[model samples]
Target: MSGLVVHSARKVDADGLVDDFWFVADDGVIIATGTGIGWHAAAQGPGRDVVDAGGHWLTPGFIDLHCHGGGGHPFDDGPEEMLEALATHRAHGTTRSLVSHVANPLASLRESLSIVADLVAVDPLILGSHLEGPFLAPSRRGAHDGAFLRDPGPEMVEELIGAARGTMRVATIAPELPNALESIGVLIEAGVVVSVGHTDADYDQAARAFEVGARMLGHAFNAMNGIHHRAPGPIIAAFENPDVTLELIVDGLHVHPKVAKLAFTAAPGRVALVTDAMAAAGAHDGDYRLGGLNVTVRDGLAVLSGTSTIAGSTLTQDVALRNAVTLVGLDPVHAVAALTHTPAHALGEDHRLGRLHAGYAADAVILDHDWTVRRVFADGVPSADPHCTPARFRMRYSFCQAGLFAYAYR
Candidate 1:
């Protein structure tokens, strides 16, 4: 494609926000970004479409590292469902995501991996697969099928890894399981990011997992132990480990805002805001299935039929960003980073997927003054239909420069 110029917006970079700026992108790569009227005047050229931001916020596109499903579809269903779920998220500003699947039978897991691998071959927006279970602690396997939970033994781990065919980006496991440490070694060696989650592991065990090459905390504090004076728990261990990136579900129901603020303050840029959203994320309140488990969505909250335990969130990345700023008291810049750059870094795709830097894909979300999505662009093309409406297109771009195009329009 040809170059496009986004002018007259308040630009936000990795460092901070700037005003009176213009950004240029050509063939899906950001070519130039500068502030002041001179840059805007210099940017005028033939065949360059200019989008006026009207002084609204301009940041990088959001990324989600841990999301199960959306748009009334679950990831465990198959490629069609996975694609449908991803489309729901993409309309809400998530340009790239890792297809997360819950615990299931080995054959089912293999099939899911194969489907994801095939999708990745043609869709770069599907970062990879996030195996969220089958190697987790049953006691803490919140929404995952406990019947399928198993120890991450060498053979089973190798089998699952091989099934991914090098397309698996992350796997969540309990650190205290048998051979879990060894499995971490194997997974890290295979270039997969290991995340500590769904476990009864205390401080020491969680710390050991981090020491053993686990670099992420899945939905921190939801499926794990809490912080205590003596124990400190996995949350503290994650906070203390600078290399670890903590995932937080900021839907106000999954976690208290005060606690979420504490996590943001404790981890700083290491916090990655994610939507552990299930099948009912973008749908109306009704019956749904998550990982073969019956779930009911009432009052926009997804829960087990008879229990208060949150099955998943009815959230999208745009709402997560709004909550991060308004509810969690996070700065807009850091909030955007948590939703975009941090998760991209976690998946080891920062070079091509996150931020608005040159050579990155032209995936973007345009928002209004109130942070509502107005327009969404995936792979340098505007999404055919967006999920929400805003006053105007404020600047927010999420790019995945690879060959895959997997964004959805509501």
Candidate 2:
């Protein structure tokens, strides 16, 4: 339970950026935070680990609500491959991540969910599993396996829910499919966040999904209908609903920068910047597989082989943050909040995992002037080395199995 203090930097969080702030964490929990000379006394304390951030940018560790894999390893592979991907993103300041899985057969998906559940039990930073799969629409299934896309039946839905064992944090569904709305109700009943995506759903249908408890739009504007002025698809529908959080892939490929800025303006605090990144992220441009689909990455853009469909992205959170500011013209504080608080709020982990305040988890990232990650602290332990090792914390964030939403689900 050693004490650690980071000071003399620009701190950004829900309170916006503050100059020359300091915070002290004991064990794995933030105990105190202040500004200016208050930290000088702590710096001289015995058994204290003090880091002078040197006026660098400091913010809460990035949280990826939707990410498949990175470092030449897909999450669908297994534990070893998933760990490899986690390590790769961890170095880039993504301290918390939901291991996303592409569409696969029902049996295969259940097995993968079990693997992720086991990992969540051991690794505090692995923030459970997000099933972006089999319950999607065939016509809008971008890189997902079309063969496995099927209607969500009560029995099938219960099986998948049972397989996850309370670790299934998110499930994506196309409201146009048969029983999809009912399935959304079931997932919400099970305390899992339902997202609308990979659908041919029009405005009314998308609106209906959100009204029924679907609170997220997965990588909006890609793999779904775009705004047609008259049509006003899911993007517009999501913009109208205050309860919804729109996931934007700020890689500037899946979504244009101008349109991305529009989302930021329209939704305000609801845009969650996600890296729908595949195995090729943080790796070389080469051939990769997303679920059962083959992908080719060239010029850092991944697309289906011999086709124009963007399979996924080769992006990490650090690059996404920079793109939000430089390419999309968003304020740096808003961009950082999109990476931190917005995603954490989307998954209902905003209670502790997102902000850099007292009583929050000791997780943060230190970025140099160019916004590249210079160091990461997970559970109050410094990951100063480029190589990342898994951290174990006492009060780690996890799926909401405690029924905190008992009234909402009731």
Best by TM-score: 2
For lDDT, the strongest prediction is 2
- lDDT (Cα, tens digit) per residue for candidate 1, span 169-276: 999989999999999999999899999999999999999999989999999889999999988999999999999999999999989999999998899888898999
- Give Cα distance to truth, residue 126, candidate 1, Å: 1.1
Residue pairs clashing, model 1 = 61-397, 61-398, 87-408, 123-404, 124-404, 363-398
Candidate lDDT (C-alpha), each: 0.82, 0.87
**Candidate 1 similarity to native, TM-score:** 0.92
Poorest stretch of ten by lDDT in candidate 1:
389-398
Where model 2 places Cα greater than 4 Å from the true spot, the runs are 384-410
Cα lDDT of model 1 overall?
A: 0.82
How close is each model in CA RMSD to the real structure? 4.7, 5.9
CA shift of 332, model 2, Å: 1.0
Worst 10 residues of 2 by lDDT: 401-410
